[model samples]
Target: MSPVLRAPLGRVMRWHRPLMLMVASMLLLVVVSVAGLAFDDRVLLGAPVWLKPFKFAVSMAVYGTTLAWMLSLPHRGRRWTSGLATVFAVAGFVDTAIVAIQAARGTFSHFNKSTASAERVMQVIFGNGVLCIMLANLALAIILAVQRVHADRAMSRAIHTGLGLAVLGMALGFLIPAQGTAQTALTTGGERVLLSSGHSVGVPDGGPGLPLTQWSTTGGDLRIPHFVGLHGLQFMLIAALLLAALAARHPLLRDDRLRARLIGVAATSYTGLIALLIWQALRAQPLIRPDALTLAAAALLAALTTLAAVAVLKAGRVSDGNPPAAQQANLDGGRVG
Candidate 1:
């Protein structure tokens, strides 16, 4: 056999490589976001644009790597993981293809100039695709939660808690009224009164006429707060998986350590991002900006967090370098038995 074919495929299949790829993918996303914010006009030029295809390619790669890693886990919930992985993988591929097609056709650049009917059809197709991905992600979270509850009660509780908080925040957002006027209106005896005007009703301007809400309803504009809040599960799950990868390097309590880290990171990052998004939503400010201060802070945070996680993982591995005599004896006995 060729040396390449004889090489260890199992080593290549290890979680570490996929984790590293995921990190790289996220960094790419951060860079793209920063570039888009910093050089909007230059980076977003017309059809067959260089950057657009590259960005979509990177996204597809990230999603594919993540799905592969998750499905490779040796867990009782393999069925669920495989199913969700397939869904996400398919969604990612479809999304990339759609974007590529649009880019080829100059739809993104000439969206405003496109015929109304063509625009409507494209909108429905893309909207449905996004909806499918969101539903698959949500379902994956629920399945994982159920599996954790049966396999590890404590981890299950943490997952459930995060899920509950996310749901609660979304519900509360809906109940709170928007700033300006009633979200809905009723006409009686030739008189009109507003019925709803809050985040809960999805009418932030107190009336349905607001451009933001109208565009959002048509899937033209995305509400940052709502989008962030709704996808809280994804963030938390990713955070948890990252910590788990870190913990797996250790020998003793490796699994437990990974689980703890995942839960902690998930909860912290999720809460922090949600709070920030909500604040921006309330103040009518963009969640992301090209401000030097914001960029610097984000870069610093990412660096510090990565360093801390690496340090903890290294320490755990060092601590678990040797097993106690009792554990060795038990292992020998089991092997003999």
Candidate 2:
């Protein structure tokens, strides 16, 4: 491939060098998710049942790539940064492995102490490992927050905001561990799982839900905000990258301050959306069954986000190289494509 053709496509995939194993595993999981949809007889929480594992796999992919990109953007890092990435990758793998393995075994992994003592012990061990991964994520977020990506201000803000919000999302998992399973109450079988927690809050698990998400059309489901917030890093980083790509073609986006503000606006609005989801869920409102209050809040948030974005765009100005810009800005200005 010519250097001209390779830079655009190759840079996106190869930059920051993501965990190859995690990437490969995610590909396999996506296939398994589809296959299970066709073949698996299991049903959990009113979904296709393999859905949990599939979702977890996809989430891990996003988490791994986002962090990998963030860490790689920098020229150097602390000695432990590499170790943290490995922890995240391993934990993600174990997470998906447990979910898929249990799914194949015809059992629940999260709140499934009801099956056998061995399974119960394994679940507890896995759960602890998950907590450790969350801590690793928190540490990464802290590092990102403090470190200045002097190379690219827009990307810097995006990384900081994304990592911060992602930590919030990851931390939300605490809710699951804190609240015991609402569905486990009815099963009068062997050794009921006391510490288990599922999606549903007001109603029991396995009811009518939205098409793919199975996000509980009936009652409160914490997973909604949790899911959205967890992807915050991806969301903002993509936006920043898109802006840079566009700016390369249309140098208007080379305005570093403007790009940074636009990213900031996006991060703020994204947080608001996540907050809305959490509020709606905590009130036991289904995603599809939003009441007047929900509609009003949603409308207000949309209007505010749009207005803020417009304001940032208006503030944008083309750079005239008054002051020497960072290497990234120059690259955005077409010095390096």
Candidate 3:
């Protein structure tokens, strides 16, 4: 890349070193997981034993990288927030490591309560790590919500809203364990065993599932909302970047306020999508087989979002004048130029 391009990219890519290292370790795990997939024929929970570890490693890498970049965006509050970042890094790694370990043992990583002391202890540790990561991310989200982390209006909105949605998505994970169907089994020694609640509602966990993703196809899967919500931050950030890239071809999008308003629309739509997924999951409806009511709700959300986008663009076209001094001062908590 040319110096001009490299300079700008460097500004955008500023990363927290520890988090980057965590991401690197996850990438290495990804490679190891792939090799496991190629050689190991073991299957657990209706999928290859290695699949869970591979998926988790990839998720950890993406989430850690996004978080590191977000932490870099803030010019202030670095001192206090740094501790939270470290907490997240440690917790995320521990959580992923436990998953990998369980995969190697050819057992379920999550929702596993095998009635063995070792299994129970491992689950406790893994659960605590996940909780720590969630709490740390929540702290980061609160900090970003209050801090003026970015100068660009659109980018600022995107970052703040994305983190908030991601936090919500992480929270949704709790529902997976809480709302799953409970079942009882008998051990070979004639001991009664109660397994942890599984992920699929109205169906067993190891039932028919979508390929690759393994989302439940025959019944509701709580992971759907959890997965979608967790990645909403990345989706919104990508949407904002795509809008910025269109500025060169579309003169109107060059205005930061206009772009920011469009981002607001996107954020609302994304939030609604999360809500819809949760509703669908709660109803014990498969994601790919939504009922009429679910479809109606989805259609309503889409129509509302489209109308909001059109309204924002129309308003932008109609009002090209600069705002009054008072209004200008109010923008971005009175920090707008």
True-structure lDDT of candidate 3 = 0.84
Q: Per-residue CA lDDT of candidate 3, range 273-298, in tens? A: 99998888888889999999999999
The TM-score obtained by model 2 is 0.83
The TM-score between candidate 3 and the true structure equals: 0.89
Q: Each candidate's lDDT (Cα)? A: 0.48, 0.76, 0.84
lDDT tens per residue, model 1, 1-337: 7777657555445644433454455456546544543554332211123344455556456545544544454456666656665665565455555555554443341122234576567656654665565566666556655555424432454555455444534443333433423433222122233332333222242222232222123111134455456545455556555544655674434556545654654465555555554544454433433245445655655665566656656666765765678998999999999
Ranked by TM-score, the better of candidates 2 and 3 is: 3
lDDT of 1: 0.48
| Residue 96, model 1: Cα distance from true site in angstroms | 1.7
Report how far off residue 204 is in candidate 3 (Å).
0.6
> Least lDDT summed over 10 consecutive residues: which range in candidate 2?
185-194
As for candidate 2, its clashing pairs are: none
**lDDT accuracy of residue 304 in candidate 1:** 59
What lDDT score is found at residue 275 in candidate 3?
91
What's the C-alpha lDDT at position 273 in model 1?
Answer: 56
Model with the higher TM-score, candidate 1 or 2: 2
